[model samples]
Target: MKKVLLLGANGQLGSDIKKVFKEDIELICLTRKNFDIAQDEISKLNKYSNIDYIVNTTSYHKTDECEDFPDKSFKVNSSFVYQLAKYSNENDITLFHISTDYVFDGMANEPYKEEDTPNPLNIYGLSKYSGEIAIQNYTKKFFIFRVSSLFGESGASGKGGNFVETMINLAKKDVPLSIISNQYMSPTHTLDIAKAIHYFIKNEIQDFGIFHCCNTGNCSWYEFTAKIFELTEINYPISKTTYEEYKTKALRPKYSVLCNSKINKYYKMPHWEIALKEYTNIKHRKI
Candidate 1:
């Protein structure tokens, strides 16, 4: 049985990954308390020398926080990733790192391809891009998945829960909510990503490089919010607004829809609407 070490196991994606891999592989999950991948030296990981793979889901991805502390952002996203890559190379462990779609400038009319040039618009994007470069430079046995707009049942504690939860809570207040319509992206389910990871591992993937992994289809935040309301039958006052009207500390790509043609070679991705429907169903059962 191949042993896999997963970082940030308590996170939205990491939580789901655990569920997906529990019965299939020898999985070891590490939260920040277990080991701080960012602050801890690479030598600390030597104890797990038997690990066959290291899936890094840890990231400093808060847009505002990244803007506030560029050093921390790079430390967690770039420097730490570089260390992992270097260690993976020396240890003969396969590395799987999660990245973001923010690396693009979001000016493209169509979805971004694997070969697309990254033009980060904010500190968060720049830091993630730096990690991507570091991984490419330091390791050959690595899989970099650039995904966008993740929502999961676990709800990222650092981000104050997932976007769907935030929207539901806001709707409960019965106040007028102005959501951005200018920025578009392919919102994905964390569970789907987990399944994709399982598929890759089961298939013993040969192609190793950056792959755009997101649910098919795209929509603006406004459309996404509207769909959420439609699914839940929640009567909430939602107004569509532009990015200019939505004041934010960090700049986001106006369009960050990533093409899944590359990953499709291994697994087919469901459309965003389908995943959203599934999420709502699971959410309702919990309530």
Candidate 2:
């Protein structure tokens, strides 16, 4: 079995990846406390000379927090990525990096393809986009998977709470909630993403490039929350609002629906909606 090193193993996607790949591969999951990327992490990782693949899911994901900590964000998101890319290239090990859909400005009327030019509007997006560029320029053997609006069981309690959990919490208080309706993108389940990554690794399809990995269908944040309420039997008052009205410190993409045609053509996975329903059913014990 090939040895795979996973960074940010406590995060949503990293946890999902651990669940899926633990039995299949020799896995090394690293937490921030164990291995911080800000310090001499690349040098430390180089000590693991036998690792076959390095999957980095660690990111500074606080969209608003990035505004105040742009330097920290770049240090983790961009500079660390460069270090990993350089190390991976020298070591001849495959690198799998997770990126965000926020790299786009959301000005396009259609879903973003792998070949589209990125125009980020916020520091978070810019940092992620910088990482993407670093990977492209610094390494040739890397897989960059860009996804959007991720939600899963592991995400429910960490950092900023997930949308599903937040809605569930609000339901307990019987309070009305307002969600932005104008923003649109595929809300990908972390489990499905993990499965896709596993498929890529197992197949050994090493065509290194960027791929859009998200659910097949597109929906606004409001619609996604509404579905969550409906599925969980939560009788909370949820209202649809515009992004303009719910002004955030960070500017979110109005539309960032990623077309999964590339991934579909290369690797076969279940449809995103089907995967989402499966996630909800498994988590809540009902759909």
Candidate 3:
């Protein structure tokens, strides 16, 4: 079996990948305790001797919190990723890194293509974009999968609880919800992402480049939340709000919906809403 080293294994995406690929690969997941990417590169290289692939799911995901902790965000998102890319290049290991859709400025009316130039508005996007640059400069065999609005069984906590869960909880408490209607994205399922990565690995695609990996369709945050309430049979009163209403330190893009044309042509996954229905039905015993 091929050996794979997964950084940030406890994270939502990492955990889902772990659950899916544990039996097929010799999986080694490292958290902050086992291996700190912020440490020196020499030490990081020494810890993992012979790994075939390194999937880095670790990220400073708190977009709002990043304003207060820019240094820490850069360390994990940029500097550490640079070191990992260097190591992967030197060791001839395929490096797969997860990136957010925040890298784009969200000014485009259409979905962002892989060739689009990134003009990140905030520290988090800058750091992630920096990481992407590092990989491009350092490694020959690297895959940068950019996704957005991820919600999964494992990512509930990271994403401020799953969209469905939060809506259900709020509904049960009889609280009215206000979601942003202006901000748009194709909400991705982590399970589908894992399967897509696995598909690429199985086919041994050596063409290392950036790929957009998200569900088929797109919707605004308000529309997405409404869908969650609809699917869960929760009649929570949801009010439409603009991005301006939900002010945060980070400047989110007005529209960060990624185009699936490339991934669909190469490695297609299911539609966003369909995947959500499947996940909710499986987990909540309803479709």
Candidate 4:
């Protein structure tokens, strides 16, 4: 069996990857606390040099929090990525790095593609884009996947859980939700990302470069929330708001819907609406 080292095992995406790769591959899963990349814990790979792939799912992704700690943001998102890229290059290991769609300035009329030039509007986006550049410069065998608005079974520990669950919890209070309508995105599911990774590793892709691995289609935050309630049969009031009205420290991409044509060449990407409905169904079964 081919061996793979997965970092950030406890995060939403990493956790789902653990589920997807079980019994199919030789996987070594490590959480951030046990395997801190910022401290250079990656040097321990010398003991496991036989590892074939390294998938990094760790990031300092609290959008507003990134503005408060620019140093930490760059350290986790860019500097550590550069270190990993250098290591992957030297050791001849395939590196799969998870990236964000925030790299765009949210000004495009069309969905962002792999070839488009990045113009980040916030510190978070800048740091992530910097990481992408570092990986391209430092390693030849690397895959950078740009995903947007991720929600999954495992709640993001630092961000008070994933957005969908957070919104559901807020709706329990029977209060009106002021959601941003101007800002749109392809609200992707972490499960789809895990399956995409599985496809990439199984097919042994040779074209190692940036790929947009988000769900198809797009919707505003308000519409996404409405769909969540509609699927779950929950009655909640949702008010339309704009980026300006919903003030935040970090400037988010007003339109972050990613085009999946590049990755669709390798694996089929399901629509966001279908994925969202499936997620709600799974959540309901558990409850």
Candidate 5:
């Protein structure tokens, strides 16, 4: 079995990836507790020899928090990724990195493709895009999966909980939801993402660069919330508001939905509605 070094193993995506790789690959999991990507040196990786691949899900992804701590965001999202890419290049290890669809400025009327030039409006997006470029520069054996709006069984470590869980909790409390209606994105399940990555590893697919790994179709945050409420059988009040009406510290793209162009050639992605329904059924015990 091929050996894989999985970083950010405690994160929602990383956690599921571990589940997917169980008893299949020779895996070495590391969370931020064991190896801090920002502070810990990549030279330490020299201890884990014969690492065929390094799946890095480590990211400082709290968009609002990134605005206040640009240094931390860049260090975790860009600088450390650069170091990892360099290390992977020297060690002949294929690197798999997770990225966000927020790299786009969100002005596009249609879904953004992998080849679409990135024009980041916030520090977090800029840092992630920088990391993408670094990987492209330093490594040939790399897969940069640009995913969006992830929700999973394990709530995001960085954000405490995912939008789906938060919406359900708020609805259960009879709290009125004021969700953004204008910002469109592909709200993907972390399990599907893990499955997609596993497909690549299992098949040994080498067609690498940047691939948009998101659920098919798109919806606004309000629409996403409504679906969650529908699935969870919560008939709560939800008001739609634009991103400007509900102001945020970080600027979000009005349409940051990604088109899975290259990845479609490898694996077919389920629609957002289907993925969400499955997730709710299996995890939340409702659909």
Candidate 6:
């Protein structure tokens, strides 16, 4: 079995990648404890010289928090990625990195395609975009996937849990929610992204560049919250608020939905609704 070294192994996306990947592919899972990006992490990977592929799900992805700690954000999101890209290049391993849809300014009415010019609106997006550029420049064999609003069973790494969990908690406690109606995005599941990556590798899809892997359709935060309540059978009061009223430290895109035009023919991406419903169903069953 070919060995794939997975960074951020304990994060929501990383954990699901562990479970969703084919049994035939050997995964060398390494969490923050084992591979801290803040430290000189490239030196740590010298031992895994035989690794065929390196999948990076690591990020300092607290959007608002990133605005406060731009240095930390760039260190983890940009500098460390450059190091990983360099390491991947030296080792001749295919690198797969997770990115954000925040790279866009959210001005487009339709879904952003892979070819869209990235105009990051915040430090987090700028840093992630820097990482994307680094990977493209440093490594010949790499897949940079731009994912948006990701939530999973394992919970997010940087942000507390995820929007779903936060919404669930507030709804259960009878707390009124004020969701943003202007900012739109595709709320994707980590497992779906994992499955797509695994499929591409297993089938040897050499079409490597930046791929936009996200759930189908886009919705404002209010609509997303409504769906969460519907799936979990939670009736809660949620009011729609625009970006102007609901202020955050970081500037978010008004529309940041990613189109899977490239990967759709090879691996079908389920709609956000179906993915969300499936996630809720699985979590409920687990609970």
TM-score of each: 0.97, 0.96, 0.95, 0.97, 0.98, 0.97
Q: Is candidate 2 or candidate 3 better by lDDT?
A: 2
lDDT by candidate, in order shown? 0.91, 0.87, 0.85, 0.90, 0.91, 0.90
Lowest summed lDDT window (length 10), candidate 2:
156-165
- Candidate 3 lDDT, 192-262, residue by residue in tens: 88888877776778878999999988998888888887888877688888987898888999899999888
1-287 per-residue lDDT for model 4 (tens digits): 77899989899999889989998798998886678877766676677667889999999999999999999999999999998899999989999999999999888999999999999999999999999999999999999999999999887859988889888899997767899988899999999999999889977888999999999999999999999888888888889999788988888878888999999989998999999887887777532
**Which stretches in model 2 have alpha-carbon errors above 4 Å?**
156-158
- Any runs in candidate 1 off by more than 4 Å, and if so which? none
lDDT of 6 at 205: 82
State in Å the error of residue 187, model 5: 0.7
lDDT digits (tens) for residues 192-229 of candidate 6: 99999899888878888988999888888899999998
- Candidate 1, pairs of clashing residues: none
State candidate 5's TM-score. Answer: 0.98
Alpha-carbon shift of residue 101 in model 4 (angstroms):
0.5
lDDT of 2 at 152: 78
Give the alpha carbon lDDT tens digit for every residue of 193-277 in model 5.
Answer: 9999988987988897899999999999999999998988888889988887887899988899999867877889999999999
Clashing pairs in 5: none
| RMSD for each of the candidates | 1.2, 1.4, 1.6, 1.3, 0.9, 1.4
How many residue pairs collide in each prediction?
0, 0, 0, 0, 0, 0
- Which residue pairs come into collision in candidate 3? none
Candidate 6 structure, TM-score to reference? 0.97
How far residue 99's Cα lies from its native spot in candidate 4, in Å, is: 0.4
